[model samples]
Target: MQTDSKWGIYEPEKACPNDWDLFQSYCYYFSVDESNWTDSKSSCQNQESMLAEVVSTEQLAFLTTKAGEYGSKFYFLGGSDIVTEGEWIWTTSRTNFTVTNWTPSAPSDDKGKENCLEMRKGAGYQWNDVHCDKNKTYICQRPLL
Candidate 1:
């Protein structure tokens, strides 16, 4: 539980790929659901949590797989730059990502509209710019103690 803070750029750990199977306390939600990203974030909040925040490759893999298990192609993470565009950071513990999964030429401050990120289907763990109002389910991670 060594959560560190950065100026703005989140510095996620190297990797923490998951070993998902049948039994696990993993959490997941929709990436491109009917609900907008904001709504999706709200949904997660209603559950007492916001969008998910993957700290390592293993956690990332677990989350991605959990989404797949729940029949979601992609899901919204707790990370975003809505308030501070270009300064995306996780909402939980302020954990940051050092290895971004954005696709080539992504996260562009397009006309100052796009502020959220979504995991692309069939794109491993890469993300793309998306609207916050767009409806989608977000995953929430509750690591075991």
Candidate 2:
């Protein structure tokens, strides 16, 4: 077991890198800078992480709460449908969504150009699909070593 002054006790496998936040068995990094979805994904890759793959309702809630604390209006996540329209998948994990919290009437794929996923402020911090090229802050995640 390991002890963190602020977060209390955790197992060695739940240890996180400096400046990252630990939730469950994962470590998350909420970026301070903004970038397009592709660039954001690459950025996370460079950090030995991946754009956050929100796999559960609890995870989504945790992420959104952290986003609120970060005060960012939007944040890119790992979901996209660029390869197959309307078939969203976490780009890094290559896994289809088993849990979702999309805002009502969202992901309308407005103008057939919205393909990247974001947690949006206007949507009460719910998921929304937007253009992949749009720049936004991002969240990255990796399993704790």
Candidate 3:
């Protein structure tokens, strides 16, 4: 993969497909329109991909920059507590949360209705928990193929 010296920005390589941005060993798709969490997840699946999984702080930063490039207000993450409250997991990777990059007073689950994760522009692209039904732009990811 043609990545930067810091491995932050990944340029398209011979193996990379069109319309997908390469980052490390993964390819990501950022949606242009807003959709709810469930529908967003479905969209990714339809594209033979899954909602993005932020595996580390570095990856989170990289994702934050990607989301900003789309100029969207918010972007849905692959994490949710729909299965079990307060227990977030990447639906695609089936990985449990270890470290999160929340802005401040985030993941608040205000009024106890929040269950889905999103990176918000207002919060400097930090992850936040919001109601799953709320519409937002989303990111889809899949292994480099």
Candidate 4:
């Protein structure tokens, strides 16, 4: 049986649209353009996807590596605590964060205004909370249909 070094059991690759990369059962799109959290989310929706949600350590590692390849300083994720401070959730799934890779001393909700999740280069590609209005590149993902 074929196996992926990182993911163990390998799954068959599915066709992803141009500029999208297939991983497991999903297609991921790494955007070059920058936009705020809300705009990024809308952009993904327009593309029939949602902001990339990192649900596991492996998923987070995949995204962090991809971000480096994309050469982006920061990328908006699907997580946000805008509705309730300190309670981050994946906006699309509306589920609480079960696995997180936050950088030490991060998600501080700096000045009580940082509510959006971002993978930041300065944070070693770990998760951090920043102002939702801050423009940044983003990643999007959708299931293989």
Write model 2 residue lDDT over 13-50, tens digit each, in one string: 44799989999999999999999999999999999999
Candidate 4 residue-pair clash tally: 0
Ranking 1 against 2 by lDDT, winner: 2
lDDT of 4 by residue, 67-130 (tens): 8888799999999998887888999999999889899988898888999999988777888999
Query: What local distance difference test score does each model get?
Result: 0.63, 0.92, 0.86, 0.90
Task: Give the Cα-based TM-score of candidate 1 against the true structure.
Answer: 0.67
Question: Model 3: residues >4 Å from true position, as ranges?
Answer: 1-14
Model 3, span 76-129: residue lDDT tens: 989988787778888777889876887788778777689999999988888899
Clashing pairs counted in every model: 20, 0, 0, 0
Q: Would you list the clashing residue pairs of candidate 4?
A: none
Q: lDDT of candidate 2? A: 0.92
Instruction: List runs of model 1 lying over 4 Å from the truth.
Output: 1-33, 143-145
Instruction: Provide the lowest-lDDT 10-residue window in model 4.
Output: 7-16
lDDT of 4: 0.90
Better of 2 and 3 by TM-score: 2
| lDDT tens digits by residue: candidate 1, 48-137 | 555777667776666566666666666677777776768888755676665467878788768888888777666765787777777665
